[model samples]
Target: MKNTSAVILFAAMLASLVSCKTGGKALLPNVSGKAGEVAVVIDKENWEGSLGTEVKGLLARDCEYLPQREPLYSLVNVSPSAFADLFKYHRNIVMFNIAPDVEKQEIVYRTDVWAKTQCLIQINASCADSASVLLERNGENIAEAIEQAERNRVIINTLQYEETKLGDEIAKMIGGRIHIPVGYNFKKVTDNFIWIADEKQYSTQGIFVYRCPAEDEDPFTLEKIVARRNEVLKNNVPGMFENTYMTTSEYVVPGVRFLKYKGRDFVETRGLWEVKNDFMGGPFVSHSFYSKDGKEIIVLEAWVYAAKFDKRQFMRQTESFLYSFEWDKE
Candidate 1:
């Protein structure tokens, strides 16, 4: 009877939490932590034990494109009891609950439970052994979910910024619009290509917009996309020296996947790009989708060049703009 009552109380508490909504407090920007940072709620003993190591390896592993060490997400571990109001409102959070009596291991995800535009992933495990097995099986899914949530937050924040003058300009040129935040300029514009960039002292973030005729045959295959990208960059994106131009790096093959965002279907690609005959290179991410009319294939890409600092934040900031892609209403 006592156990049943306890469970009932817990359910009621969770229900209350989900029901209670804030006016505008929770919708505001997450000011508690930096971009790509996650708050981890777990017990200290477990955090210091093997479980801790496993969790760190999965979430805090090194992010690509940084010269020095930089984790994919900077993790701030907090004991379950110490998870206070500040941590509750963070943008990204992961909590683990372990119990010997737990029937099975499971992962639960919730959004806006405590605050708006927040993602919380909780893992319940029967024991340490179960926890290990569960993490090994579902670690990738958890990581991907966290990343998607972060991207969503970025889109929301950008919209709130309301820097639509550049977006409107791009919409006029490309027949579509994407949120372009302040501090970016139209570096170059041509018939088939456009370059917008936010140039900084030690880092440079930019976006490339271009389009081509949509052939009846699918032109989005990996081979076709790479060929198109190479050709576009070669002609429009030049380098510091003669015969030198930006091209996709042959050293590391680009990763490609299909996804649907905001009613638009896109083939997303992530890869390194290099300047031929030059020593400059960095990472690039692109979204290739067909225009609303189905007559043209548009590619919106964000790339980063930050030699002295961590690239994760820079990449996140620029890539967020890609998610802002929206079709203009006629």
Candidate 2:
């Protein structure tokens, strides 16, 4: 796999150099102006319109080699029976259209790199059947092109397969998961939180979460801890923390929040805020308990955040995550 990746990388580099020879001019014969240009046809007999505008956006962003906006050239609904012969002489072309009655979109993508052109047709439903057909300088055999194009289609479809698998796993664990909508600006999953059990110590779990704090709060202080806990309990309907926790008029640092809930001690501290402002908000809460007359202390720490989300939902999710914690016994 590593070697294959390396070869692909090298090939891409070589293709880029070849593509640049004519100052990035289109490599295939310019048929847009020629008479009787073969129009690539789409067979919508089995196609269902499942492709959404989001998929189109992804193609535009990820596959920049093909013209998307205003499409340099297009051939729509050319008779499918003639598609094979239409492009027999020309291997480089971009073809796209929605299937007749399908709810999703489908696109047939091909591009020229030097004299070799690769063709791939993808339907939102069965994207994996698409193949990347690589044609030699002489010409591409229609049968061989179709077979290879199917293989490439399968490769492209792997992405959807992995996504569906992960989505199923997440659905089994939690009520919901977070994902950026298709057209939104890309942002890292900073606000999402998860808890993972320690590898060596099966009973112990680390609480991992991120937050953007309010301007007045310092994430590391005891005061912040009390305030956040109280706020969480108030807004989160299923929260565990209640009035049993006492707010302390003390500070691990000045202006920091401190609190003790039940028998567990907690402190909140601030962190570097990256997105909204110069300062980012962060809170680390943990339970510390003593065994055998306070001789040994066991501290279980968790990161917390209150960022751009529904407070009730965030609290509920955080509470559920926190409840999964368990102490490891030696």
Candidate 3:
């Protein structure tokens, strides 16, 4: 199997280069493999030992807001020699190099080393004990790096597959640009709000964009945001029932956090949503930021309704839309 994968990898690399040259422009290969997939290159013995357990615990941590306990990432363990041409281009990778002569443990991160839209994290340590210690200390950071790599992959993939007409229309209305993949359509559009969704047989993923009046007293506070969310859903998102509409689920309290990305600060909210008087419900995430003019609060929300299967990948795929947001300077 390892030899076969290596052969396929070489063929793909050759094909990509040839195609790029023929096309008159350099085109990096699209990210290969599924979202949230990670490749770990380590010796077989170490991978099957205590270090392997630690690696799995950290990288495969359970995801939240899902019906069943699904791993945060699906890790593929490959021996050092098997990390060849094609495998080198995995979207996310962690390589462990253990040597007795090495004195200190260090982690090196690189991007696009072997292919486009890839992240490689290398951990160097002197011995097994040192490597285990380093892993224990930096487990969280490593996991985050892997996760961020996938997020970046999503952004790049979205841009590559964007629907220009839909993107332009949304940009004009929202005063900014977002990568709306071709399959997504404008479900509802109003002066102050937009609802875009990718409807599938078993699930529906969506992105919601809206602006609300920005006030001095932290308009993005949890209390204020939830209040505004209910108002927006009630007005724009209607359910099948006579008096039903979408709103945050009261059964499970939502979580709020602050994060800084691409020089912008945003308040992020995560929770479940249910139709007020209907049985339909799912998970939703929103990122709120103040517009450049400071006149309104711009919030980008991504939600998923996949009742029949695990939702970790679905949520991650939709969440990438929020990160791809960029304000168009007027």
Candidate 4:
């Protein structure tokens, strides 16, 4: 594998130079491999040891808020000498380099190194133990980098195929920016609540936008948020059956996370929603924050229902639309 990769590298570099001469522009090939996959570049010996265990635990942990157990990332081992050509262009990669002369261990995060929008995390250490320590200390930060990169691609695609008329209404209503991708239409629109959905033969993807007076002193508490969500859905969202309304599922406890993105702070809540007196359920994620005027709390929620298929990527694709939050107040 090593020898073959080296030969492929020589040919790839030559092709790159030739492409540059043709248009006076160096166009990189689009990123390869499936989403949620990471290529771990290490030597055979080190990959079988404790350091590899730590790397897998960080990157391969199960994604949260899903109905079934699915790893956050599927890892493919690419030994040091075999990391060339095609494998070098994977969407996500974590590479380890240990040298005798290296005095300190450092973890570096890089993007678009060999492919556009690709995320590469490199760990430089003097030995395997040093690498393990670094991974333990910066695991969350590293995992977040990969996660952001994956979502960024989705957001980029969503921008190209947005729903303009719907965006205009959403902007006028909330005085802010959020992308509503194609294939969605307003299912219900009211003064304080809006429901948009894309219902298909085998799946259902929906988004809910809500605005309410910031009356509660502690508005972001778990109890307050869940209660508000249940109330809103109960009044607005209903099932196909008579007397059925949507509500938060209590079988599994709902969760909330306070995090920041692009200098904006918001609380993210995740849980399952089921219809009252009916047999319909799926996962939902919402981002809540105070509006610009500080007079109302705005919530953006996405949910997925694909009974016969995997929900991980489906939920991921829909939830990414919420992150395109830019205050469009004029």
What does candidate 2's lDDT look like per residue over 211-272, in tens digits? 32334423444444555543442332122233232221132332333545434454433221
Q: What residue pairs clash in candidate 3, if any at all?
A: none
Q: In candidate 1, which residue ranges exceed 4 Å CA deviation? A: 1-31, 64-69, 101-104
For candidate 2, the per-residue lDDT at 317 reads 27
Model 1 clash count equals: 0
Query: Comparing 2 and 4 by lDDT, which wins?
Result: 4
TM-scores for all candidates: the values are: 0.86, 0.19, 0.86, 0.90
229-287 per-residue lDDT for model 1 (tens digits): 99999999889899999999898788899988767789998888889999888889999
lDDT (10s digit) by residue, model 3, range 281-304: 888899998888788888899999
Candidate 4 per-residue lDDT, tens place, 1-330, comes to 544553354356436435534643246566888988899988877888888888888888888888888788889998765677558788998887676556667997877666778887878787788888898899999988988898898888889998977777777788876787889999998988888888999999998999989999989999999999998999999899899999999988989999998888899999998889988888999999998888999999999988888888889888888888787846
Q: What value does the lDDT take at residue 297 in candidate 1? A: 87
Q: How far does residue 26 in candidate 4 sit from its true spot (Å)?
A: 5.7
lDDT of 2 at 96: 33
Winner by TM-score = 4
Overall local distance difference test of candidate 4: 0.84
Q: Which candidate number would show the highest lDDT if scored against the true structure?
A: 4
Sorted on TM-score, best first, the list reads 4, 1, 3, 2
Q: Model 3 clash tally?
A: 0
Question: Judged by TM-score relative to the true structure, which candidate is superior, 2 or 4?
Answer: 4
